[model samples]
Target: MGGFEDREKAFEAKYARDEEVAFRVTARRNRLLGQWAAAQMKLTPEETEAYAKSVVQADFEEAGDEDVVRKLVGDLTAAGIAIDESTVRVAIEEMAAEARRQFMEAK
Candidate 1:
């Protein structure tokens, strides 16, 4: 019984670690994407990082990528980037499509 409990604890710990790693990887990917988008707006590196972090904050769990893209569009617009809704929508769709591709690839 003691060995069984120990094995269960070990399994839980491994799952926790995996979840953390997955979260970090997703976070880093979003930050990188934000930085890439910010570059197109001619923002400084620090500004880009700030922008990226903000994007990460809007994740809101399952909403995830769409929310990030939505916020990116809003932030860029607020920064006077001259982007319109149609363009932002298009970009969001494209990104979602790309993510779908990556997800399928991973499987």
Candidate 2:
């Protein structure tokens, strides 16, 4: 764990090959996101998983709408990926506005 990049590479390799470790890590990440979102919403950590799951699923499966963005940002505290919620929000909002404009123009 102390070897920095080497450790991270090792962990990634393990994650690629070890289902158990992957699952444990995934659950831990979810727990982290849940805790973060729960704090934002003033809820308990125990009460956060459902929300986190919903948010995570929406981000992956939905149309990338405001709800998806809101939920994603609200709960994405433990994400290893470096993304800023404000940037995501702005991008989504721009897309939504452009979609609306195009739809209206076509009518």
Candidate 3:
């Protein structure tokens, strides 16, 4: 019983840590994507930082990545940048992969 309880506790702890890492990676990816978009829009440094934070917050608007994609596409279009949803989605996937790699390397 003691061994089983210890194993259960370890699994719970591992699950929590994995969740935290996933959250951090997603946030980092959003920031990277925002900065990429901001650069394309030629935003100033202050504006870029704010934009990045906005991208991170955009994730909370829904359960999936659509919210972030919509925000990026709309903002980029409004800024006169030629962009499509498919392109933005591809960028998101690439950025997410990069973000995961970076987090893994840092660990």
User: Which candidate number maximizes lDDT?
Assistant: 3
Report per-prediction Cα RMSD to one decimal. Answer: 5.3, 17.2, 0.9
1 or 3, which is superior by TM-score? 3
What's the TM-score of each model vs. the native?
0.64, 0.35, 0.95
Q: In candidate 2, what are the lDDT values of residues 1-107, reduced to their tens digit?
A: 46898989998888776776434444344444545555556666556767656644554454435556566564454543445778656645554455445545655
Q: Report the C-alpha lDDT of model 3 over 1-107, residue by residue, as the tens digit.
A: 99999999999999999999999999999999999999999999999999999999999999999999999999999999989999999999999999999999998
Cα error, residue 83 of model 2, in Å, equals 10
How should the candidates be ordered by lDDT, best one leading? 3, 1, 2
Candidate 2 to truth, TM: 0.35
Whose TM-score is higher: candidate 1's or candidate 2's?
1
Tell me model 3's lDDT, rounded to 2 decimals: 0.96
* Cα error, candidate 3, residue 34 (Å): 0.6
Candidates' lDDT values, in order? 0.71, 0.55, 0.96
Ranking by TM-score: 3, 1, 2
